[model samples]
Target: MRKRALDTVFALAQQDERVVYIGSDVGQGTLQGFQESIPERFFVEAISEAYVIGMAAGMAMTGFVPYVNTIATFLTRRCLDQIAVDLCIGNHPVRLVANGGGLVYAPLGPTHEAIEDIALMRCLPNMTVLVPCDAEEMERAVRASLDWSGPIYIRIARGGESVVSLPERGFFIGKAIEVRQGEKLLIATTGVMLQTALEVQDIMARAGYNLGIVHFHTVKPLDTAWLANQLGPYSHVASLEEHSVIGGLGSALAEWLCENGDHKLKRFGIPDRFADRFGNQAKLLSYFGLDAASIAKELQAWVKPS
Candidate 1:
């Protein structure tokens, strides 16, 4: 997914002279094609994440669209001031391609984990938060970011996630895609959690429960119209994300529900506590009760037989 998004940025650079690629302490051969093709526009800097963000903001002011790539934690947590003051304040069109979102770096421990990235990015003004489910969706998000008006934060997962998004339904920024249609219950999700939601949907189906699924790739500037419309018919609405329960997709839904409707909502995400254990991504997800089986079990408890 990360490679595909970077490739899209390279392709966009080929077509647009205003496009630039900046990396902060990345691997030696990272975006090598972009460097070789457009040496003047490519920048590889050291461990200075704040400096990189300030530089990207300055380039945006100069009418250049800069795509900054780095670890998710460094981009969101390390450069919060620069992101808030430089990018969000002015509404720059800088594309932040964040790698290792959620628990993708679980083996590297909590410092490397980006569990709060969504919440952090969503709180900033003029920041568009996106969590693509797979490489295909990542390509679409990257392509769309080229024309998007403000600072865009694209949260990328570890590669080889299942492709749950269909091309036929099409991809649109700030639009929710309904992957499955049913009644009584709605399962709204973002990022790679869509895959787990789909699995849970199938499990519930086999057990005689119909689960509807909505995929929200674009978190901020959320598809409220779709959510508001779809949520009305269901008796229960649940939000699933690979992020914290606070200030993420689930929280966003909760906030919306308070203003719009009186629907019952169950949020499934990491608790508001640091994951102090070291393990693979899959293990950590299961440990946090985000695996498909655990999600299905939770759903079975929430939506009882009529």
Candidate 2:
């Protein structure tokens, strides 16, 4: 997914001279290609995340579309004031490419976890939050962001994600993509958890539980009308994400459903408490009941015949 995003941005820079890439001490081998291709446009801010945003904002002020890549926590949590005021309030064409979203860097402890990034960024007036489900979606998002005129947040999983294989034209900012068709339950997922929802849908199908999957890749300015229509028939609905249950996708969906009178929903995500244990991504996901087995168990208990 990271490679796809980098390659897409590099390709966009080839055609649009307005595009630039800036990093906050990010010298990964994956970024080497962009540095080689557009050395004049790529920059390293030497660990100053706030300066990175300031520089990106300065570039945007001069009509350059700057894309800043960094760890999720540092990019948003550390430099939030710059993001909210400099980029968002200014409505600059600065694309925030944040990797390791939603505890993908769980092994590094809470400091590295970005469980509330979406909620934090979504509060800004002009910020557009995008959580691509896979590499293909990330590529599409990159292409779209090149021409986008305002600030945008692109949250990507760490690495090693399956190909979503959706058409380029099919990707839209305010539309939800229906991945599967089922009868009893609707699975609304964002980020890499959308893949998990697909796996769970297959498992539930074999177990005779019909499930519908809706990939809500865009968290901000959610596609509520589309979601409400799809969720109208299901007796039970599930909202899933890799972020916190508070003010994240679960809360967004719940608020939308309540405002629209769509109820009987289940929320699956990280709890409010800080995760004290240090472990790998899979372990952390399992510990939070975000693993497929645990999610299935929870759904069975909640959706049992009543």
Tell me the whole-model lDDT of each prediction, alpha carbons only: 0.92, 0.86
Q: Using Cα atoms with residue i matched to residue i, what is each candidate's TM-score against the true structure?
A: 0.98, 0.95
**Predicted structure 2, TM vs. truth:** 0.95
Kindly report which residue pairs in candidate 1 clash with one another.
none
lDDT of 2 at 282: 84
Q: Which digits, one per residue and each the tens of the lDDT, describe model 2 over residues 1-306?
A: 887897888899889899898878876575787788789998877988988999999999999999899899999899999998899888999999998998788878999999989889988899989999889888888887787779999998968878764784378886888887777788989989988998887777777788988888888879987875677567778999999998888888888888775468889999997789888888999999999988988888788632
| Model 2, residue 247: C-alpha shift (Å) | 1.4
Candidate 2: how large is its RMSD? 1.6
Which pairs clash (backbone N, Cα, C closer than 3 Å) in model 2? none
User: What C-alpha lDDT does candidate 2 achieve relative to the native structure?
Assistant: 0.86
What is the per-residue lDDT of model 1 for residues 1-306, given as tens digits with 9 covering 90 to 100? 999999999999999999999999988898899999899999999999999999999999999999999999999999999999999999999999999999999999999999999999999999999999999999988988898989999999999998877878777889999988888889999999999998988889889988889999999989999976777568888999999999999999999988987889999999999997888999999999999999989889888843
